[model samples]
Target: MKNQAYRMALLYDFYGDMLTDRQKEFYDLYYNEDLSLAEIAENYGITRQGVRDVIVRAEAVLTELEDKTGIIRRFHKMQEQFAQIADALDGICQLNEDRYQDDALEGLCAQIRSVLSDLKQE
Candidate 1:
């Protein structure tokens, strides 16, 4: 369906717990596990159309939640800000190293980079 897997995953991440257990299971199988609708239907002992309907309804729920809360939008904005901060830190470190060659400054820069790395990982 136009390769919306990434968007679907992000929506699921933000709002998946709101879904019923059955909806979550089918959504995970179809989207996260990359299973075809037919495969999911086979596994669940349902028609392919039934599996598709569940996934589609789950996706609509996720989209509605995102529209109302805007949490995912804010999250992406925060990530962009963090990336900008990391880039600025990198530039400052480069300038400090070029001008001063101070070991203490280098150590501080290393710590900052480590913190940024950890944040990005999370």
Candidate 2:
């Protein structure tokens, strides 16, 4: 259940702008704010089922966008690849410290780490 919610949140992060305003609000309330359907319904003066419908439609939109574009999927893949690169750089840095003590190599690793950090921030 938690993982499902997390995926929905990530989907929203990727494609939320495509949703209608009401759908966006209801989805955010249910997923990000952790609001129950009943609570959101009460605040919005609607039925719980109505709130659920809006959130469901928002989810459908997000999922459809992902299916069409695969942007979120690619983003996750890039993040995993970046992590692998980071780990490799860490190993190289350790080897340098223990054996080589090469200043130029260390500087190169630092540069790569900086670029990796910037990519991950996106």
Candidate 3:
């Protein structure tokens, strides 16, 4: 349940602007705010079932969008790749630190860092 909630939050973060205002509100209250369905219904002056229905519909829309676009999946893959690149760079820096005291190693590390910083900004 906790994992599902986290995934829902991530999905919302990625595609929430696509949701209707009411849908976004309900989703935020129910998932992000950790509100009960009854609490959301009371806040919105609706029945618990109505709140549930809206959340279910919102989840469906989010899932459909993810299935079609796969932006979130790609983003995760990119993050993993970046981590791997960073790790490789760290290993190279460590291994070459003793062998090379020149600016070449420092220049290579600086370039990698610059590239990583640019990618993260995107």
Model 3 steric clash pairs: none
Candidates in order have lDDT scores of: 0.92, 0.91, 0.91
Error of 3 at 87 (Å): 0.9
TM-scores across all candidates?
0.80, 0.89, 0.93
- Write model 2 residue lDDT over 15-122, tens digit each, in one string: 899999889888888888899999999998999999998888888889999999999889889988998999999999999999999999999999999998998886
| Model 1 error, position 117 (Å) | 3.1
Sort all candidates by TM-score, best to worst.
3, 2, 1
Once fitted onto the true fold, the runs of candidate 2 whose alpha carbons sit more than 4 angstroms away are: none
Instruction: Give the range of the ten consecutive residues with the poorest summed lDDT in model 2.
Output: 52-61
Q: Which ten residues in a row have the lowest lDDT in candidate 1?
A: 1-10
- Superposed on all Cα atoms, the candidates' RMSDs to the truth, in angstroms, are 2.3, 1.5, 1.2
User: What residue runs in model 1 are displaced by over 4 Å at the alpha carbon?
Assistant: 1-3, 102-108
8-96 in candidate 3: lDDT tens per residue? 98899999999999999999998878899999999879999999999999999999999999999999999999999999988888877
lDDT of the structure predicted as candidate 2: 0.91
lDDT of 1 by residue, 13-119 (tens): 88999999999999999888889999999988999999999998999999999999999999999899898988999898999888988899889989988988898
